[model samples]
Target: MNNIKKSQLFWASCLALLVTSLSFGIRAGILGKLGTDFQLTATELGTITATAFWGFPLAVVIGGFIVDAIGMKRLLVMAFIFHLLGIVLTIFAQGYWTLFISTLLIGIANGTVEAACNPLVATIYPDNKTTKLNHFHLWFPGGIFLGTLIVILFNSIGLSWQIQVAIMIVPTLVYGYLFSKLDFPVTERVASGVSTATMYKSVTSPLFIFMFICMFGTAITELFTGQWIDVLLKNVTDNAILILTLTTGVMVIGRGLAEPIVHRFSPQGVLLISAILAALGLYLLSTLTGNAIYFAAFIFGLGVCYFWPTMLGFVAENIPKSGALGLNLMGGAGMFAVSVYTIFMGGFYDRLILKKLPAGANEADYLSAAPGTEMANLLNEAKNAAGPEVLQATLVIPIILVVAFTGLVIYMKNKKKEALTH
Candidate 1:
C-alpha cells in the first residue's frame, strides 16, 4: 500500500470502529430520554434496543458476497453511508416505531463494517493478524469513550439527544471520504483460483459452530452491557454515563494491552477470565445497595475488552486460507450470537421483578420506581409482588453459559494444536 492509501486505510479503520461503538453508546445515553419523549412502554423500548442486532446476522452473511463482488473499500464506504444515514434518521425519529427502524438500519451499517474491515485488517497485517486485530479493535471502546464524552458534554449543554446524535455525522463523513481514497485488498481465494462456493462451505465446519457459540457470549458481554448499562446502572447511581465511561475506559485499556496478554496467557485463558469478570460484573451491577457495583463494572470491562474482536481474530488465525469469506462468516456468526442473546435477555428481563418485598414497602412502590431502581428501596414499606430472587437465579444462567463457552474455545485451540502436531 502507498503511504497515503495506508494512512487512508488507517483512519478509515479507526473511524469505522469509532462509529460502531458510538452507535450503541449514543443509544445508551439517550434511551432514558427517548423513552420519555416517545411515551414508550417497556415492551416498545425493548424492541428498539433489540432492533440493533436484527440486521447484524444478515450483514455478516451478505457481506461475504459483497466484499468479494465489489471490494473492501467500496463496502466500507457503503457501511459509512448506512451508519450516517442511521444516525440522521435517528435524529428525526418522532415515535417508537421510527426509532426502532432507525436502530435496525444502524445495526446493518455496523455489521457490514465488521464484514469488510475485519478481513481488511488481516490482509493488511497478514504476518501479525492477532496483534493488528487487537489494535484495530481498540477503537471500539475508544469510540465509546469519545461518544460518552459528547453525551456528557452536550447533555450538560441541554442538547437534546437528537442534536447530540447528529454530531456523529462529522466523523462519518470523514471516514467515508478517507475510505474513498484507499485501495482495499483483493480476495485471496480469487487470487489463487478458489471458487466462492467452496469458501462459503468452510464456515459450516464444526470448528466454526463452536466458535459461533463463543461469539454469542461475547455479544452478551459487549452489547448486552453497552446498550443496557445506563438502564442497569440506573439502579445504583443517577450518573449512568460515569459507569458507562468507567466500563469503556477499562475496555480500551484492556484491549490496548491485549496483544501482550494473548501472547502470555493465550486467548482462551483471557476468555476464561473474561467470562468470570462478566458474570461478577452483572451480579454487582444488579445489586444496587453495594459498593461492589463499581468493582464489578471495572472487572467486567476488563474481561470483555478484547472478547469480540479477538474472536474474529481467532477464526482468521485458525483458518487463514478462508480469506474474506471466513472473516465475514465468523463476523456474521458473531452478530447472530448477539441477536440471540438480545432476544433471550429480552425474554428474561420480565423475570427480574422484585418479589421479596424488603420490609414495609408495597408492590406498587417497586413498580413505580425508576428504570434501574433496586428492590432494596421497599425497605419495610413495599410489598414485592413479583418472583422471589429474580436475578438471584437468572444471572447464574449467564455465568454457566459463559464458562462452558470458554471451554469450547479451549477445545478449538487444542484441536488445532493436535491437528498441527499430527
Candidate 2:
C-alpha cells in the first residue's frame, strides 16, 4: 500500500534466504538417495554439487555490477524466477547434466538474494552493519533447521523427495508477493555517487584483498563442511537429519544471541574467537565420536555463525567506498571457495571409499555396511578416520585465520584509539 519499508524488505530477504537454505537442506538430505538412484560415485556427486557453488559467484559478481543500474527489486525478481525454475528442473532431474544445470540455476538465485539483500541491509541500517547483518543472516541457519525437520518428517511418512522440494514453493511465492508491490531503494554507492573507479579501487585495496582471501577459508570452513553433513555423518548416526538440524539449530540460536557479543567485542574480536572455536570444532569432529561429536558440531556452528555476515559487515563499515561491488565480491569469493572445496572433498571421499571397501564394491554393498555390525564398524571407522583427515586439512585455514584476524583486531583497535584522540 505504501513505499517499501526496510522491515518489509528485510523479511522478504529472509524468506529468500530461507528458500536458498531450504534447497541446501533438501540437497544434503537427499545425497544418499540421489547417489543410489543415479548410480553415481562421490566424485560424480561432488561434481554435481559444485555447480551450485560455481554459479553463485558468477551471478553475484555480475549482479553486483548491474544492481545499481537495474534496481534491487528487479534483481530480486530475477532471483525469484530462477529459484522457481531451478526447483522445477531439480525435481525432474534425470542425471548428471540435468541436476548440474538445475542446481547451477538455483545457485545463481541464491547468490542473487545475497547480492541484493546484503547491500540492502547495509544501506538501510548503516550505523549497525555488523549486528544487523548478523541478524539478517540468522534466517540462513534457521531455514536449514526448518528444512531438515521437514525432510525428516516427510521421510518418516514415506513421502517422495520431489514433494520435499516442492514444499519450498510456498515460501518462494510468499516472498514474491511480499516484494511485488513494495518500492525499492537506491543503492548506497549510487546515493553517495561513489565513482566506478572508486569501487574498483576499494576492491583492490590491501585490506579488502586480505579480507577477500580470508573469505575462502571461512566459507569452506562453514559451507563445505555444512553441505556434506548428511554424508559425513551417515555412518556416525541414524538421524543425520537431526544432526543437520542440531548443527544449524545451534547456529540459529548462536546468531540470534549475537547482538550482545557484537556489542561488547568488535567484529574482528568476534571473528578471532570464531576462528579458534571453528578450528577446535573441526578437529573434534575429526577426532571425537558419539556424544562428543554433537558438542563439536555445536562449537563448529557457533564458530561459523558469524563469519560470513560479520565479514560482509566489516567490509560495509570499513570499506564504505567499495559499495555493493565489495559486498557482492565477498559473497562471490566465499561461494567460489565452497565450489572448489566441494569438488576436492568429494573426490577425496571417492578415493577414501575405494581404499576402505573392496575394489568392486557396489551401492548395495556400501549401503549394507550397517551401524553396529562388523562391516558397518569397518565402514564407520574408515569414515571417522578419513573424515577427520579432511577436516584436519581444513583446520589449517582457520589456524591461519587466527593469525590474520588477530592482526586485524590490533589494527582496528589502534585505528579506534586514533579516532578517539583526534
lDDT of 2 by residue, 299-409 (tens): 888888899888998899899999999999999999999999999888888667657765675534665555577765665566655665667777888899999999999
* Candidate 1 weakest lDDT stretch, 10 residues: 379-388
Which runs in model 2 stand beyond 4 Å of their true positions? 1-4, 359-385
> Over the stretch 234-277, how does candidate 1's per-residue lDDT look in tens digits?
65566666777888889888777777888886666666777777
Worst 10 residues of 2 by lDDT: 362-371
- Local distance difference test scores for all models: 0.71, 0.85
Q: What is the lDDT of residue 386 in candidate 2?
A: 63
Off by over 4 Å in 1: 2-4, 192-194, 288-291, 350-394, 405-422
Identify the candidate with maximal lDDT.
2
TM-score of each: 0.86, 0.93
